[model samples]
Target: MRLEQADPKRLVAESYRIEGITDGECRSIFIDWALSLPVGVDARQAIKRLLAEYRGTAPDHPMTAVLRAGLHKAPQARRRGGARGRRI
Candidate 1:
């Protein structure tokens, strides 16, 4: 996927330009990027595309690590109200 499609807001791209950016900051920026994507855009594909775009130039970047972590995290389904959610 094109960088434009993956990161329309350029949040991830801009994060790389910020010097000394921390992992927490990267994570925050990544969240912003994720939230900015158009509905129906696959976030993992976007993250992978961003990773591919930047990895060679900034493998050590905190954003890179955040993107990698984003790729690995599984979507966990949780009950909205615990056992009370169960129909008796």
Candidate 2:
């Protein structure tokens, strides 16, 4: 009963089809793909599915690399040398 595809626009899928696609291009496409997901859809799960879909077919594709990178959550950066945290 799913209403939409995990990749509604197939941006990720198309990225793999592109010739000589770069990581930067893949990144841009990934961003658009992520934003295009229907509200309430789980992005993590979508990413996993996308990875599985392309992994075997295009293991070295830039889009596949981008999707794999997307699976990881970046660490929060803390401010350094901030005066606000200092007190007299």
Candidate 3:
């Protein structure tokens, strides 16, 4: 669920809540969570907030790595010229 001003994906939050959850499962949920975000949302900031919230609780959880990866990931630029439009 979206916290105050963070707007983190609910799936990600729920994944963290799952007991004995696997890294693969969390990774899958993370993919969905990332995809569900609105365009232009600051994913790194959201992930940082999430990590802060869960820090002392699940330090060893696989979600921590996933969140960290999300945080460190560079913003991807949209790739154009796939043959959709615009002749050079």
Encode model 3's per-residue lDDT on 1-88: one tens digit a residue: 2464354447766877899999899898888877877777677777777788886788888988888887664888875776774556
- lDDT of model 1, residue 80: 77
Pairs in clash, predicted candidate 1: none
- The total of clashing pairs for model 1 equals 0
lDDT of 3 at 14: 84
Q: How close is candidate 2 to the true structure, as a TM-score?
A: 0.85
lDDT of 2 by residue, 1-88 (tens): 1324678887877788889999999999999998899888898888888877779989988888888889899989976677875745
Q: Which candidate achieves the best lDDT against the true structure?
A: 1
Choose 1 or 2, whichever is better by TM-score.
Answer: 2
lDDT of each: 0.90, 0.83, 0.76
Distance from true location, Cα of 12 in model 1, Å: 0.3
TM-score result, candidate 1: 0.83
The residue-level lDDT of candidate 3 at 84 comes to 72
Q: Pick the candidate with the highest TM-score.
A: 2
**Of 2 and 3, the candidate ranking higher by lDDT:** 2
